[model samples]
Target: MTEDTLRSVNPATGELLAEWPIDDEASVTATVERARVVASFWRELGFDGRKQALLRWASYLVRNTDELTELIHKENGKPAEDAYLELMLVLEHIDWAAKNAKRALAPKRVSPGPFMANHEAVVEHPPLGVVGVIGPWNYPIYTPTGSVAYALAAGNTVVFKPSEYTTSIGVWYARSFALANPQLPGGILTAVTGFGATGAALVTSGVDKIAFTGSTPTGKRIMAAAAETLTPVLLECGGKDAAIVAHDADVSAAADAIAWAAMANSGQTCVGTERVYVDETVYDRFLAELKSKLDNLKPGSGADASYGPMTMPKQIDLVREHIADALERGGRALVGGLESVGDRFIGPVVLIDTPEDSRAVTEETFGPTLTVRKVKSVDEAVELTNASEFGLASTVFSKSHGMEIGRRLRVGATSINAPLSFGAISALPFGGTGASGIGRIHGEEGLREFTRTHSFARQRFAIPGMALLSFGRKASTVAVIRRVIGLKHGRHS
Candidate 1:
């Protein structure tokens, strides 16, 4: 039997905000089948037609920003202003997907190669039938929309399953899109509500691809389940991203950027700065500046606070555990420490002298916490930063060698002199390496992730004397081909 209702509650006050009927096995299968049928009509619309429909949906989001912002605040406990910013960024991504999809996915001619010079070749990208998206509650609109918008732009239908805690927000996304484009088929963009079992159903429900965002362990489970059907998956797992400060970095600017990145959204971000490496030349100055900034920051349920309560209650315990491990291993808190982790609202924390082997230094704390370590040089900083298996995104602040140093990071995205700036630009792809997950979302790479490509070639004419592809060629033709290959490639070796 299907579960009755999935309740969405406010993490801060434990208030039940809304309830949605959980989609069971039968419902989930039906939804996928419906999407498969609707995908034909969606693909027939072509890029320009789909672009218009997506633009209308973007307009709907803009018009209802206030309502959506409130829902996000209630569901995820982020500050209203932060929630609004997230909505605006999603709008930007939608616009990019709409305007660039046709150009990016359009068929293009390619040279046929030397042996088949008389042939014409072309490559085309086609939409995968239906895409399944499993979203996270943190930045619900922005994160899921990254997959949804690109999938729609690429002429594929979408079946979105948002985090259980933000089920209503997911419903609002689908409802708003439908209202904006009433002519669109119902299953072109659908939302299913449920827990982990529902997501498992989607993975095996015959979808072409799945885009998931959450913890590394959960990502592993999803991948294993998808492996049953050989279904391709794009896993945007979380990160223990690092921030490196060079000796030449602007002490104040670096401190401010790190502080904001660490504390924003209560540090529920996948690419947020969790560990920091500062060169010894400016280590003390950076810490002093960072501590000063953290002192003014406060976490609370009110909108006036710098950040709100933790969106996931269990994350608080993880934060406390990591901090305890660091402290027990000779780490000292320069700012708020173990006591700062409240029941829901976790205050800002800045730790120094944390051992390299400490949990705080190695794990994805996923909280408003920062572990700073002093390094002798930028190379040491890079080596230390790359120590973790989680390589999602990283940041570096340097005056003359910012880009040079950032290139050393083994992350999917890196920001120079900025914190998590890679996530703002719709043109830059976002994801991670190693345990941070695989595949990419956002930008041109994102549009391609939801589609497959096919290449075709046709012979315009045949050379009268050339029978190289057949056995009819003379022995001299083989000699001539050998000489040609020798002349072309012999010098390279």
Candidate 2:
């Protein structure tokens, strides 16, 4: 591909908005090497300096909100309003990281065991040198910043590779930060652009750690590539997340949350609600309310529309195939039929009474499509929810037993009466187990994720005969040690 000729085509109007050169392998390697050099300086600056720099970056984001949001909309094919929301959430994460980095990464005095009482023990989180981040296109700012901001605040220089589909937005993010903090080292936050090969190169590069957010297959590939260098990695992969509605749940409220979770950002969200399990008692009522809420949703490539075109064109066929499989397998379209899908935008698609084994129920149809199934009870709902390979995120909508059901579902974070809103809290650890990927970002866990713990101990006083070379009464010393342990921790006979 011609690097300089690369352009970001607006999915809305099929117009070329901007173009930039694709950073080649040599450029990527040089950037990472420079980051490693700068990381030494960034790490030595201590938490205060790093936190202030992050805060300044957050302020810059807020000040340039309009310009950034418009760029995001043009590049990602999301509504300008939704793009703004993504940017705002990213800023929130930056603010939180700056305020909490010291406490989260500071050393603490740990208790020494009785045998080592004369020594003082301390454990501290230290930076892991340069970090490589391979970000996704959806929620371009929020998703990547979850790793990038936290990594930076933890004192690790970052080399970020934004999704090839949204490279312009990524460039815009890095450029703005550089403009805001010109005093920082140039490589403190560097941006590279390319396809899978570029991302693969990043993973195998000499970075101490790699953080990736993408599909399950790509996540596996990243893990394999990281293994070549035995480098540590954090993978935030795909999810077939579900929302469970209990008998006592408020049907109208559940409907609203479900619609937003399944359709937001054109249903391109990693933690978006794709499957919904409703108690048979309120199944009919819940379906009615959900359909009514989705009735007025308009999906198109325009400013006034609720959602815009799919950022990735290939996803449209997948959406169509999933809907077709569900209908072919006796699934009923409660609100939107197959005709709802457009050339670029997919209108709201709500599948009701979908069979548990159908593609719509089992696979992740990352579109404005939701599969609703009626279950006998909350136990059944939980069972069906946990059956999927993905356990990224889920929701429980119940007035009396919201927390109860939320705990039963196997996922990273479960929201009560909400839809994937747990991600909004920077104090909460995000990421999933199982096929959803490993490790976490955000909160105190995020700060530690980018660091390695080092333990130090220093003897305050020297005791005679403690060293093996010292000449002493060894039999008497052993007897005294045994007696002391027996008097202190021996079980009563």
Candidate 3:
């Protein structure tokens, strides 16, 4: 790989910000090999060594929070405040993984069956050699670090291929790892820069495991590619998450959550609530409150702005098309229309009277657009919410039955009287089911996800029955054996 070959363009301004090298196949392979060797040494360091090293990395992130946030903002086109939030979340994961990896991944004893009582059984978690991570452009640091930090804590070396759109932040992350521990090999925490081809190379580069975060289609492609190498994968794909506002819900609080969930980061979040199901009894009132809140949101790339431009310019057209399709199909835009989209940032959009089957409700717009639908009961709300092929995160607001409704919704995690709150807690497992993808990455599962379980059985001594089996066997011996076995294991009391 050569330096200063690829340029990083700011999506908000279309300006050339920075340039980086394009890592080729040879370099990627070499990096993977280096990771394999380093992983061996890292595994030997055990939980305490890895934990201390990760804590040092967390400290670095905390000490240089502003600089890291700035790089994230410049590379991903998010507001500085949101970038800071991302860094904070990443640090939380780093802290949690360091503290919990030992208990979560350590070997544990298991009971052997009576037939094998002379043997001792234990299961140990071993590192999966090298792990390849293909991260998304949105929430660059927080999203990938959920996997990267956990993988490291589990004793696996990582080769992270951040989205080409946010390669600078990726470089910054890898540089931080090097600065924290120079003894660590290059592949222990490596960064590879390129387009989709580079990501594809990482998935197929004979890695022990691959953790990917992106669209469903891209996830399917990555899974297919990994299948060729029989490598396990953890995919965090797209989600058309829904927010339900019951009649008993707190109107103001629900409105605030919906506004933040839909418009934050210009609604480029995978788990952002795109569709809203409001009880018909309070539909008008909820819509009014939501509209009032949306009206105050200002979209721009300035330091003080509430939201930033869409990180990927091409998504703007898709947002437009979805809105246009909904309008053509008898849907009405209550707050914003075609004029809401600008050269870079898109103003907040709230739509109502949209058909259930409209593209606006069914597909992932990935923009600052919220589609509100009226339902008669919570059953109807859950039906509409689960109608989509994507099932990631969801939110339900009901003072009386928030937990009930949340449990019924088909999503990985649900927030009651809140939005994206479940993800904020590093103790919970985060990932979706169905088309949203499989597997999890957080909490104890997160650490174990990057490791392979190894079972160890040690034979203590041979049983008398087994030793006498080849010596001699008689009818009386068989009767005695049966009686002993029956007395030991077959009694009802």
Q: TM-score of model 1 relative to the true fold?
A: 0.98
The parts of candidate 1 lying over 4 Å away from their true place are 1-3, 471-473
Give all TM-scores, in the order shown.
0.98, 0.97, 0.95
Q: For residues 1-493, write the lDDT of model 3, one tens digit per residue.
A: 2453778888878888888778778878888888888888888988999999899888888889889888777778888889988888888999999999999988899998866688899999998889999899888888998899999999999999988888898889978987887776566798888888888888888899999999999999999988887889999999999999999999989999999999998999999989999999988899889988988788877877888888888899999999998999998999989899887889998888889888888888999999998999999999989888998999999999999888897889999998899888998999998889988998998888998889998989876555434656567667877888999989976
User: Candidate 1, 320: how far from true, in Å?
Assistant: 1.2
Clashes of each: 0, 0, 0
Candidate 2: give the clashing pairs.
none
C-alpha lDDT values of all predictions:
0.91, 0.89, 0.88
Provide C-alpha RMSD values for all models, in order: 1.4, 1.7, 2.5
Model 3 global lDDT (CA atoms, 0 to 1):
0.88
Model 1 Cα lDDT, one tens digit per residue, 1-493: 2357888899999998877888888899999999999899999999999999999999998998899999888888888999999998999999999999999999999999897899999999999999999999888999998899999999999999999878988999988889999987788999998998899889999999999999899999999999988999999998989999999999999999999999899988888999999999999899889988888899887867899899888889999999999999899999989999889888898888999888898889989999999999999999999989999999999999998998888989999898788889999998899999999989999999999999999889988767788879888888888998899889884
- What 10-residue stretch in candidate 1 is worst by lDDT? 1-10
Q: For candidate 1, list the clashing residue pairs, or say none.
A: none
Relative to the true structure, candidate 3 reaches a TM of 0.95
**True-vs-predicted CA distance for residue 182, candidate 2, Å:** 1.5
